[model samples]
Target: MSLPPHPSSSRRSRLDAYQSLDSRSPTTTPTLSPPLQPFAKRVDSFTSSSSLLSLDSPYLGANRPLSFGEQKLTSSKFTLPHNHMLYLTPDFKEDDDELHMPEPKGQRLGIERDGDFASWRGFVNLGALTLVIVAWIALFAGYPIIYHFTSHRWTNLGAFNLGGTNGTGQVPIMPFHFAVIDPDTPPSAYSKPSWNDPSTSMELVFSDEFNVDGRTFYPGDDPYWEAVDLHYWETNNLEWYDPAAITTQAGNLVITLEAKETHGLDYQGGMMSTWNKFCFTGGYVEANVSLPGLNNVAGLWPAIWTMGNLGRAGYGASLEGMWPYSYDACDVGTVANQSVNGVPVAATINGDAGNGGVLSYLPGQKLSRCTCQNANDDPSKGLLVHPGPKHGDGTFVGRSAPEIDMFEAQVGGGDVPTGEVSQSAQWAPFNAGYIWQNTSTNEVIANPSISVQNTYIGGITQQATSVVTNTDQNCYEGVLGCYSIYGFEYVPGFDNAYITWVSNNQISWTLNGAGLAADAAVEISARPVSQEPMYIIMNLGMSHNFGPVDLPEIPFPVHLKVDYIRVYQRADQKNVGCNPEGFPTIDYINQYAEAYNNPNLTTWVGDYQQTFPGNSFLGQC
Candidate 1:
């Protein structure tokens, strides 16, 4: 700017300066100014002897070979390596256009898109929904199937045939009903005995004549008879009562006993009872029957007996104490306030309905209340006597429940006496000491113990009051064979003050021949008295109490036949002590449900159903 030098002089100075810079460093030359391009071109072609323009000049063309030091400078940090360099065409120029990378494409980008993810989400949701539906179906369908075989229908298929129909109607498993029998004899044809002069004439109150062939006596088939299909726990018998085993043929009610495994027992038998159907008080009851033959009589205990209406045949309850107590006067002035099984009996029909309460008078019946002060007043007077009305735990007990046995005949086996039949009256005066009583306060005692507080009378043992054995083969065979007539005559003290029992082998076709003569040959008792109402129970049982059954010797199927059963009451004293009202209805469904839920109560081990203390039968006395 201040007096600039000549161009040639300036250029020469610049070239000399560039040469000086190049000589300082042989590998690199300083960048030539843009205005000195002509000078650079000239220097590139120069081939001079001078060192500045020699062939070894640092200012070389692009095609010139680089020296070792030049090669080292090419790899400086300022420049990129050949492999990392952007690809370019041979004619590529550094222009203003933007670079274009390959269009971005990958799986990760596609997954982030909402449209594609929605489909994936739907599939996942469908899978989750399907799983939920499957779970719901499994819950609903599986429960009842699991519950059915394990709990429901267990007893119906195993323990007893609880559901079925006879020709009559639908039959319930409980409150069993029996057959009604109309006797061939008319009331007017019978003559009054000499002992019944003041009493009215005898009228037939209950009768059952087995005249119909192939008549079934199952539950609901007959109004007067019901069969029990259960194991008899009282005597620990080896027989299970089968309803199918009781039938009638050839003018007789037949109870068949079969030696086969039934339920848990080694045998099956037939048992019929008039429970809740026909009951009598002061009356004359008679039955003609034939016992099982002596061929395979081992462990056979066939019998005819009567129990109070307050007890069920094969169930456990506080009311079962009503049996074995034949005398009604045993409880006179005592306050019957005691509860049974913790159930208060202050208010119910006959004191307590199902808890073993006293049922003295029935509907449309007369009450014959009396007190005990004489020989009959003593509870310890007969065989199978009970102690006074005091529990073992110092608690007051209820009234006495009584039973009367027309005959409990023992078939010969082991220590049991054969050909011997026993007749007795039994009672339980104390509330404790029975399987049906409160176990916490009482010990089970079927027979009375000799104690200081009560009088022990003659023939007061644990068994029968009297036993009779027939040695006459004519009494068992011939036209009169197995046709013995057993009669129980009770004349309440109102008009006649005597009770009579007659056993005669005489069979009369007409009602006139069935007379109660006071002959000593057929008369058994004239002293015992019972005023309470009673029901009839007939069964063919095999007892371990007698002896184990000789299985091979058994005639497979044995029969006990009964021609007829008749009950007679004075015309003026009809329905006097009878229980016109049947037993209370039980909730068997709830009972079964309870058994199903409780593992301890279910009968799953050795047997098909729960029997005794593990299971309880509902009853109302």
Candidate 2:
């Protein structure tokens, strides 16, 4: 006897095919009518014949046979063979095992036999599975094409806001690359200069054009600058650097030096520097500066210079070390005699090691002296020089002293007064001096490249001396009309050593881009060139002890108007070093203790007591 095949075999195969197809697509299973009730009732009785049905039916393939209880035959509208039709009868063969269903010959076995409803179910399930797979493939292949057309249609119709003024009257925010600028607008007028040569290309890293309106002073609540409101005692300068004297007006920075009583000092001045805010190794730095009254002022020392940033704190501890070794100072006036026009003038570039050697004054040690030409003239004397140790070769040996006086000039006659009666007989002079020491032998050496008309050395036993006078006729008279560009280019030697065969450090100047007379600039192929970073500084000082037998009275309320200060660096110089450490901040009570040597120097927190209330006073020194 034969029983019906299992219903699960056909259903499981169709379900497996559906899963193997893409799961993202929609799928459906075919619905079948309920199985014949007679077949369901006879399923238990035909368990022994289930294996035979599995082998005979083509739909079952080689699958294992199902038990009689597992087979469920559904109704079908098809003809049946006589032998197979007996299995469909409700009362067919429970006890008599002789009755059997015959397999159909030369035909799809289950389709020709009426009671083989499992084969019909399998055919319906396979067809449904094929339709689902085809639908899934169509959807997966057509999605990209549909998306492209839909997006294009919306974009062309302006349905999406791509960036234009919105209903709120503001432009929609977009990426920076898409923004546009008007071509008619001009670039910034005070922007950094652009160079055509690639080797000299400069990128402006820091600057201040002083263009801010209503700004009375710099770094005014701005973190990029720190105002220096303290006094400097290293040079024994007469003026106290007060922040109140610093102001900004007419789009320029003005530092006023007035002879007013402040902090027990006879003169009050202003000084400002970028100690920690910014510093660079080597650059072309320049400023358009106008000096104060130059007529008959013997001690007015106004300078624009720079100092090394090493070992300096941003606050009170900035000057931790001395200055000569680390500074590049440009003193605008160094006068020896009264000017022909009553206004004396000169320019001096001084570089040295700060406090490296001892400074002592000897009594009655007259090196050299010169007298005036007439009876009313005051006597002139050479500067009292320092002494050095005597050497075995009869030449005195000096300590390793390095100094660079890149340029020095005077508008009047030399130290020796000329006997000429006319005031026009006074001569304008220029000078450059340097004293370089051999690091190995400590012997003083004079630079051969610089030329001087008259040289002076050996003041007192001649330990070491250097002096150079101007051979050129043109001398700057240190006046307001002398608005010229002055700068220095310090290129390091090979391997950044102290000395090299090719000398590159030079001091230069130009009047409105036109070169001055011959021998105006100085180049020293000498040792002791500074190899450290330097920061910029500007100040007005008095009584530096440089010239004249009698100190000339200085005019009060002297104003040093600076148009701008700019720094530029070459594109290829790689060793642009900087110091990031800042010194600890000292409280007001203990400020300037080292400089004054008196622990009782007064200190105030705010810009003096006059600007703010009594609450601003930190403490008295």
Candidate 3:
């Protein structure tokens, strides 16, 4: 009774809004049946297997032409697979009554024809609408594969989580060795420790329990000794001392660095040292190296310096005097300060220098000296002998006794009578109390019990009634440098200048030379006045900035290995038991050997405390 429109004509309705082919035009046109059109020999080829037809053929003779009726016949192979062509099938059965409706009256040409045409058009219209809805759904719900390949990241966030692959964990965390440069010491004398290999280990012990920090110096920087380089020598080289060259090998330490060269260096390098970060402050620190290099020059040097808990903070202080000129008037003829946070500080009793103050380093009682002087007799000299001609710290010699030198002058000697003079070198010793009277000019500053010329090892001095005066200015108001903040110089040589601390103060301290206990010695004094914990640092530095030397070559992969650095914190269960900042005693110092995967617990690094060039958040000034 009806035939479908041609494929092209069927899709025309979807392309334009023109007055469509009149719906009322002609339904009686006998709906072009197969009798008016040609058909293919393979009729089932037009219909997919899922439809009512299927095609499976072995041959179709070249000249064969299927008859009209045979060409219209469809296959009944119902077992074939499904496909899009299945939609073309007449969905009704031969016996289906509704599909067998009488021919529509559309040929009548008016309202009736229009009604008939509309009924047939309804099926096509419904199909078009359904197809549109399906296409829209697929577009919105699917994630396009093309998008994934273009953007490197899954999202537009543009960031990634790298995890812990960064390289910070790979560096060795502990400082393994230390080398000191004092005014009196010779530069070429650099050698290896008596224990461990020079390139792999160090035999220096600096524990909070054994608080024996030493001092070092650079040219024109030892505001304390004020050493005058008569030869104007320069010290810019250092090396790793091997085991065959060490002096002592404590079970806790490996090798030592004893002066090996005979030609002395007179630069005012600082008497730098450190403590803790490894051992408790109540611990002990001992180095078996001596100053065969420091025959007579003044100026101090430090081997170690620790605090109650200095390893954790940026700035801190605890009773320790490794660099005496750093605070006391040890280099009285020179001008330098020993201070903290830009304030004058002292920690020794050398003569009239500490007259009004106790052995404890206090604020106001700084050993005051006269105005700075350029010449040897200006009476005032600057502490800390740095490299520049105008630099301070080197107006004197290291290891030598101090005197006014009002008569016979030396390079750093003074040329004035604060009051009078007593060339007698008869300064008395400190027992409890003592006195003296300078009948000439009568200028008395202090009358400390212990006093004697050449006898007072490394501190300031003043007879019975003489105007109190400070000599070294290393720790003095350091113009605009590191000491500028802490007015006093942190000299390494002073009274019992340096005291050692162990897990408790009972730890013993001894010095040795060539691997045996010798002349180098130290006794523990009272604790520092600060409340901060301590840290450890070993460096062969020149005053402030550090630079590579041009003369000597630094072998790649060379190391300053530390055999061990034992620490002892007097277990008080109260106060000094743990660190003030890095408390609870974080692993008694990492003592690892290899440079990777830190396994031991007695290691630390000096790079963590660098300042000046830039401030190190860990243990900085």
Query: Which candidate number maximizes lDDT?
Result: 1
Pairwise TM-score winner, candidates 1 and 3: 1
lDDT of each: 0.46, 0.35, 0.23
Error of 1 at 278 (Å): 0.8
| C-alpha TM-scores of all predictions | 0.45, 0.38, 0.23
Report the C-alpha displacement of residue 496, candidate 2, in angstroms: 6.9
Model 3 spans with C-alpha error above 4 angstroms: 1-303, 307-535, 541-559, 563-621
RMSD of 1: 26.5
Model 1, range 106-136, lDDT digits (tens) per residue?
4335543334445778999999999999888
lDDT of 2 by residue, 1-621 (tens): 998667998898888854544343333223344333333213345454566445554434234544443333322323233244357786776765434434454234435544555687899899999989988876897677675544311111011123321111122233322222112112452233322233445543335555443344233232223345556664466777786787667766677888787788878888766433345555455555455555333455555555444323222222221222211111111111111122222112321123222111111111001111121122452211211222344322111111222222222244742111000000011212222222322211234333222233211111122223221221112343244333334443223322111011222211110111112222211222333445566666564542341234455677766666565665565233233112111121122223222212321122121111111011210
- Candidate 2 overall Cα lDDT vs. reference? 0.35
What lDDT tens digits, residue by residue, belong to model 3 across residues 1-621?
899888888677654422332232443121212232223233565565333222333223223445655443423222222332354577734555446556465533333543544555797888889988877766664445444543222111101101110011111111222212222222332232221112432222222111212322222111111111111112222332122322122221112223333234322221122222122222222232111111112111112223222121111111111112111122221221222332222223222344554232321111111212222332353322111122156322111111111111011223531111111111111111222222222221132221112222222222111121222232211111111010000112222222211111111111111111111111111111122233333322121111222222211221111223332222221122222322222221221112111112112233222111111111221
Q: How well does model 1 score by local distance difference test?
A: 0.46
